[model samples]
Target: MRWGVLGASAAISRRVMPAIAAGGPTTLAAVAGRPQSAARTTEVAAAYGARAHHDYGALLADPAIEAVYIALPNSEHVGWTLRALDAGKHVLVEKPMALSEADAVRVQEAADAARRTVMEAFMYRFHPQQRRAADLLASGEIGDLRVVRASFAFLMGAAPGDIRLAPGLGGGATWDVGCYAVDAAMLHFGRAPRAVRAVLSRRPGADVDTSGTVLLDFGEGRSAVLDHSMDYGPRSWMELQGTHGSITIRNAWAGADEDGTLTVLGYAGTREESVPAADHYRLQVLALTDAARAGTPAPIPLSDSLRTVRVLEAVFASAADDGAAVPVAEEGTG
Candidate 1:
């Protein structure tokens, strides 16, 4: 698969680009950046044997590019994805695929119309540890899942100008890190929450949330409590409480350091398992390519992305109301 990366984003330059170059049957065919960042784009493209385009349109127009990895900001995801699909390119848009569920659904419609393979890039889901956890749950090792608690946060220091803290551009702790916690919960539960209640705190004078804690109810005693913050020190972990046992995952999102670890506690006793150290970014690209080659559906489907955005919308709504529970509308219900 020939992949072109749109935007010389930090994630692209530091992570996904290198992963694509080093992994699987995919080639880093081209890279584009804003017109002002042409020099940087060229430098990065040169390092990867890819063509450099100062304008994103030029990259989309390139006939040699088979797919596009969109590392644009959260607000730009749906628009660029629609354009890429119209340009006859498969797309891998970064997570929180759109700012709202309506936008995500529109993107899905466009992709279906264009018959392109489009996916939200939740790289962590491709990690072996996540796969192993799924296997365990299916095997009834943890019995029936009852409750989930997840947290993903990191101290941003004094960089007020940082994009995560920017007034607009979808800057906020929830949009930045809370999405990961919610996504992980959905991955385990395999269902969208019926209701969500949340409390979000914004930094002084900032319009966006700086931190938030959300509760998702799936009914029948299945629920999740997810917390995220940008003002807090580095912290990431998830603990799933089930009927027979529990599964705890540290470093649930990136897993960039050590091998992914999950510990299980049950009547038999406590046991820990380690999945091989793997580059989730690389794994994501490989999985996309493999699906393309094998004529299979994407590893993560649009329906799943829609569900995630629905939950996100519910959380935001609940936060706006000071933790008043908000009903989540199932996709297509409205």
Candidate 2:
């Protein structure tokens, strides 16, 4: 499979693009963006020896591009993902996949009808440390699943007119960073929470949340807590606690080094440990390629992402009601 990038988003140009360049099954083919930004896109693509286009549609229309990565702002996710899928291109879109559940459903429906793969790019899930964390839980390192606490946050800093603070760009800690925390909790628990509640701090007159706390109740049996912030300081931390032992993942969001020598706080000892894979993004690309080639569902199903949206929506709703707990969707999320 040959992959094309929809825009020269920093994440792609830096972390994600380098991993794809590290040589998995597929090759980077081309990158595209608005003409005003294509110069930078072209520069990055040239560094990788790939073609560059000024028009995004033209890039998608290119017959050689089998798969494409959509790294646009959060608000543009649904439209571009659907467009790419409709153009007969498989997609790896940045999370959260859409601004609303309806948009996510539309994107997934388009993919289903086209028999194309559309994966939400929660790249952290592809890391071997995450799998290792899961393994630790399964191996009874943590006696019985009790509580999972994860946080992914950092100060976006004061960038005047930045999209992160603008409501129209789908900017906010909730969609920007909170989604990762939610994704981590859901993935660790391996199911939607039984109930969710949130507390959000909003900038005056801004329609977006800057920082928030999400409390997820798995059931009478388990619970997960996640916190996200766009202001404060730099931090990426996670811990899983149970009856026996616990697991700690420092720098969980950004991923570890190639050998997966991430600082793991566990029974193995609190030191850097080597995981199987080298690069998280490469693993994600490889998974996407295999899923697209096999005509099967993504490793993380689209419905799972939709369910997350429902959870976020419920969080906001609950917050609106002064943090009253709200149940996750019971059924019908196609």
Candidate 3:
């Protein structure tokens, strides 16, 4: 598969682009960046041996590019994804596919209309450790799952112009890091939440949240507790507690050369397993490329993206209401 990148962001230059070059049966054909960053874009493209286009449309128009990785900011995800689909190119967009459920549905409709594959770039989902954990849950090694606790946080420097702290750019602790916890919970429970209640903390004069805690009720005594922050010490992990035992995953989201661990405790005994280090980004690229070639559904379908966004919407609403519980709207409805 031949690929084009829509931005010259750090993630693109340092991770996905390199993954494309080394990932199986894929080529880094082109890259596009804003006109103001033409030099940086050219430098990035040259490093990867790909053509550079200052305008995103020019890269999309390239006949040799079969798919595109949209690394633009959260606000630009939906628009660029729709444009890429319209250009007859498959899309693998960054996480939080949309800031809202409506935009996610729009992207889904456009992808279906274009008969193109579209996937959210939740690279961690492609990691082998995730699969192992899922298998353990499926095998009933942890009886019936009753609760999930997940958190992802890191300190953000007091930079005045960081995009993650900009409201207009869809920046917030929940949107930036909380989505991973929400996604992990949903992945384990295999269903969307029924309701959500959240509380957020914002620094003085800041319009966006710097930290938040959310409770998702999945009904029937099943639930997830999630918390995220941009002003906390680094921590990332998820634990699933069940009737019989529990499973804890350390560093749940593995990056390049980062190995994770899974510990399962039950009536039988406590066992710890080491997950081999792997580049999930490379795995993600290969998976999407293979799916595109086979003309099959995306590895991470748009519907899943919609559910995640719906839950996020409920979280934000609840926070705005002073932590009052908010019901998550059903799919295809308001």
Model 1: per-residue lDDT, tens digit, 1-334?
8999998966679988988788458899999999999899999999999999999989999999988999887778888899999999989889879988889889989988897888889988988888888888888988999999999988876575677776568888988899999988988998898999999998677668899999999899999998999878589888889999998887777554568889999999999997777888888888877776676789899899999988898898998898999998876794
TM-score of 2: 0.92
State each model's CA lDDT, in order. Answer: 0.87, 0.82, 0.91
Largest TM-score belongs to which candidate? Answer: 3
Model 2 lDDT tens row, 8-110: 8776788777766666588888989889986797898899988998989999999999999888888889999988988999999988898878887898789
Cα lDDT tens digits, model 3, 1-334, are 8999999987678988989988459999899999999999999999989999999999999989999999988999999999899899999998879998889989989989998999999998988889899999999989999999998999987788888888999998889999999999998998888899999999777789999999999999999998999889598888999999999998887677888899999999999999898889988899888898898987788889999999999898999999999998776676
Ranking by TM-score: 3, 1, 2
Q: Which stretches of candidate 3 lie over 4 Å from their true place?
A: none
lDDT of 2: 0.82
TM-scores of all models?
Answer: 0.97, 0.92, 0.98
